[model samples]
Target: MDVLTAIRGRRSIRSFKGDEIEPEKIEVLKDALVWAPSAGNLQSRFFYFVYNDDVKRRLVGAALGQGFILEAPLVVVGCADIRRIAVRYRERGVYLYCIEDLACSIQNMMLAAYSEGLGSVWVGAFHENEVAGILEMPENHRPLAIVPVGYPDEDPVPPERVAHKDTVKEVF
Candidate 1:
């Protein structure tokens, strides 16, 4: 699917078919992350793919028992290399830029997954320290999101959105 079409079609897939994602498609999702525009081109964001069922169960536990996480075939974790950010761009990099960089890259990967006929959900409600430990993450690398990806079994309708009038204000 095209970019705009993917953007409009993308939904938080809470139910998955548990089908294996093609290795080539997984590569595409990884590429999308590396190519995401990073603040100051620092590119401190990183990802870890979890395919093991046991690990997925641990992740589900860390994510407040979001059982659906264990049902997806793959989980892509967005993490930040804070040490790299600190050295490259200092305090602002540590506190702000790295977080934004992670979000951008994760969004890119999500869009890439959708384009490749895969489903994914961005999971932020997680126990960061627990996930970091479970993933064997470095002390400076913080887990930002846990995105479960797979073939969707359920078609979830888009949730309500705030109307433009209330959400957007035009000064121009």
Candidate 2:
């Protein structure tokens, strides 16, 4: 599917079929992460895929009872390596670009999954400390998003969107 098609069709999949994701699709998602734009090409973002059932359950707890996490066969945890950004661009980069970099990577992964006919949801409402603890993440890596990807069992109609004219303002 094209980028626009993917963007328009993608939905937050809260329910997923038990079917396993193909390794090829997983590789494409990984490539999407690596290829995503990052500040100064420093690539502060990191990702971890969780497949174990116990780990998925722990993640659901970390996500503050978002039990949908347990339904998917895989969860891609997006993280930001703030230390790397700080080394490259100091505190300002860490504060500004690190989170954005992580977010961009997640968007790319989500779109790529959609293009591959897989389903994914971008989950950011989780407790960061709890997630880090659950994943046993390194000290410098901060978790930003937990994306559960699989064959969608539920077809969610797109949520309402505000008209573009009202949402955007011209400065120049």
Which run of 10 residues does model 2 get worst, by summed lDDT? 87-96
Please give the TM-score that candidate 2 achieves against the real structure.
0.97
Please give the lDDT score for candidate 1. 0.92
Candidate 2 per-residue lDDT, tens place, 40-150, comes to 999998898999999999899888899999999999999999999999799888888989999898999999998888899988888999899988889999999999999
Error of 1 at 100 (Å): 0.5
Off by over 4 Å in 1: none
RMSD of each: 1.0, 1.0
**How many angstroms is residue 154 displaced in model 1 relative to the true structure, after the best TM-score fit?**
0.6
TM-score of each: 0.96, 0.97
Q: Could you tell me which residue pairs clash in candidate 1?
A: none
Please, what are the lDDT tens digits per residue for candidate 1 over residues 1-172? 7889988889999899957999999999999989998988989888899999999999999999999999999999899889889987899999999999999999999999988888899999999999999999989899999999999898898888888999989998
Off by over 4 Å in 2: none
